[model samples]
Target: MRENLAPVSSQNMAFTDCTKPTDLSTEKKRKNWRNRIGFLLKTNSSESTLHIMKNRSCRPTADDVNQWAQSLDTLLSHKYGKAAFCVFLKSEFCEENIEFWTACEDFRTHTSHKELVSKANSMYEEFIKSEAPKEINLDFHTKNAIVQSLHEPTATSFQSAQRKVYSLMENNSYPRFIHSDLYKELCDAARREGKHIKS
Candidate 1:
């Protein structure tokens, strides 16, 4: 009878290694990196949504249709206005402003220090860094302020940049979106449906 065959210890090293104790601290680091990657992936998905919305015109409900016709402040304040404005920015190929503004809004809701830092870095790399893909037009002072705050990012790190973008949209893009055919069609539909528009 032939001797019973046995697996070599070296051959079983792979299986043994799989059962080794994992470093808890290292595991935590891995999880943090994963969260960071998730943040970036989410950002990409947002742009994808913008692309989709750009292809289709907005259809506002009765309550919001009249809100867009009001002052820019009123329009920007309402959820419907923000959505419509994003579509308008996408159409203009300048959705970065709105994206940055939205990012800022998200930052305000963060309570964890780790999450705040991670998100702030992601935003800076994506929208604030030189030659960043989504860099918005910002004044020297505003850019300088953002750069200084990166050392220890806070919720307001992007405050100056956000304000500048908001002003740009309010003064430039907001007016144009109001007159766009998309807006006109939405307004017309509301009227045909007998929706009362606020003067």
Candidate 2:
């Protein structure tokens, strides 16, 4: 039996299990969380109204898991690998980097001027402002440049900051991720998958 969990907090958002479709309070909180994350996604079902996370359970071969070790980009480009990495980051309480990074990526795909402006503003308040919730570390110059761009928001507004975050992850979290137990467990599972494939 699933129990209602205590409210969990991210850097700026609060989340709890999507208990049911009719739980207005719970639904409301989750909706806010999803909106703050800048990606409101839907799951296939009528019994749910708010869901932001995706199922990250994917079977990987040894080669697939090993490929992730090639580089941070390799891991992030693979859907499952990125999902798994998010979980790892969450465990370390440093998921904001990934969240901000992904939000910026999604920001670029928006075609509407109005939508772009709205997202850019929120992105600034959420991740770029000094001491903003979920703020990623950026140099003084980079942050200043982004603040200036907010006046006439463009698709590339977050590019420089995003690159900085990517570099930080590549040099820091990524090295630790490669050595994390989560990665090791996956590697062990993948090895079994490889052997099973042979059988």
Candidate 3:
């Protein structure tokens, strides 16, 4: 007895192996695999690899600092925001001002806060003398002293001096001119204030 076998046609074979439209999940999976392979091939290319290496090696430049300064200024103008004047002052004017330098030092030496205040006071006086005609107002001087003091209210003499200056400035009765060509008068005042507070 012989058994008859049907021949497989090209169309039948193709239909048997071909995926159906209903099998969308498998098609999606295949597409994802192709995409991953393409990405890998692109990253392995010489140009792409070089670009990645170059980006990693780049360093910050002066332009970066300028941009950062501009950003800081913008942030500072916002109300109740995380703005800092100290940062601006340090970045912009600290290098040019001696008083700022002394204040920074005073900040680090908590024990010598009074001395620092005193030193700042003196420096302001000197600054006024050197930059004469643009006299240092009593309020400015008092503020400098207070900043240097770091919130420390020292001896009676120091307190008295600060009070006197404050009173004069507040009353707007302080003398506008200095006599006897007193050089380093501001420095002297700062030094005396520091000494009195420290003692």
Candidate 4:
């Protein structure tokens, strides 16, 4: 008769390395990183969504720093909606201006009519201070040069003018920056000289 071989007991089965705690922890960290990256990508793609990464108070590894910076670049490249812009502004200028920061955040979180009006007023003031001056120049020759270069009747200039016209049409009913006093005066002077300004 052949020698009988005993069956292996359950306790004698081989131990698997997959069940180790360290391995599980590593897998969990990888999954968390992947999920964070996916969230950043989705937020960057959508204008309505805002991506506020966790504050960098804690010291992060080199890899984490690189990832955060890359995500920020992606977010900036995307077209940010009003809500997202408010959040981004809050994050960017909060330390500089607490009142403005609070107003923006409040507007983003609460859609109250009164709060919106307050936020709009603040934004208007900020816009006037930042953008109004840049739109107008003290030197008339510089302004004329810019206009002439931008409207040379070439394909490139025409395309650029088309974009400007579209932007003005969307923002203002009239294809002009009526808010700027300098622009208004320039138009008046041009009209006096019998020059027609085309959109």
Give the number of the best model, judged by TM-score.
2
Worst 10 residues of 1 by lDDT: 1-10
Clash number for candidate 2: 0
Question: What TM value does model 4 have?
Answer: 0.23
Regions of candidate 2 where Cα sits further than 4 Å from its true position: 1-58
lDDT by residue for model 3 over 1-199, one digit each (tens)?
1111111222132112112345446445444433433312224577855653465223222232223234433322332111122222222222222233233334345446566556545544443232333222233343345445544534321343334433332222111111111112322433443443357
Which residue runs of candidate 1 sit more than 4 Å off their true CA positions?
Answer: 1-59, 194-199
TM-score of each: 0.64, 0.69, 0.22, 0.23
For lDDT, candidate 3 versus 4, the one ahead is 3
Cα error, candidate 1, residue 199 (Å): 24
- Top model number, lDDT: 2
Could you tell me which residue pairs clash in candidate 3? 117-148, 118-194, 121-190, 122-190, 125-186
What is the overall TM-score of model 3 with all chains considered together? Answer: 0.22
Query: 121 in model 1: Cα distance from truth in Å?
Result: 0.6
Candidate ranking (TM-score, best to worst): 2, 1, 4, 3
RMSD per prediction, one decimal? Answer: 21.0, 13.0, 37.8, 31.8
lDDT of 1 by residue, 42-129 (tens): 1246674465345323434555667777877777677656766666566556778788988999998997888888898899889865
Q: Which lDDT tens digits does candidate 2 get at residues 75-98?
A: 998876887778666655578889
Candidate 3 achieves a global lDDT of: 0.32
Write the residue-wise lDDT of candidate 4 on 23-142 in tens digits: 445345444433433322223343313232242222222333223233433322333212232232222222122233233334455355565455444433442122331121112332
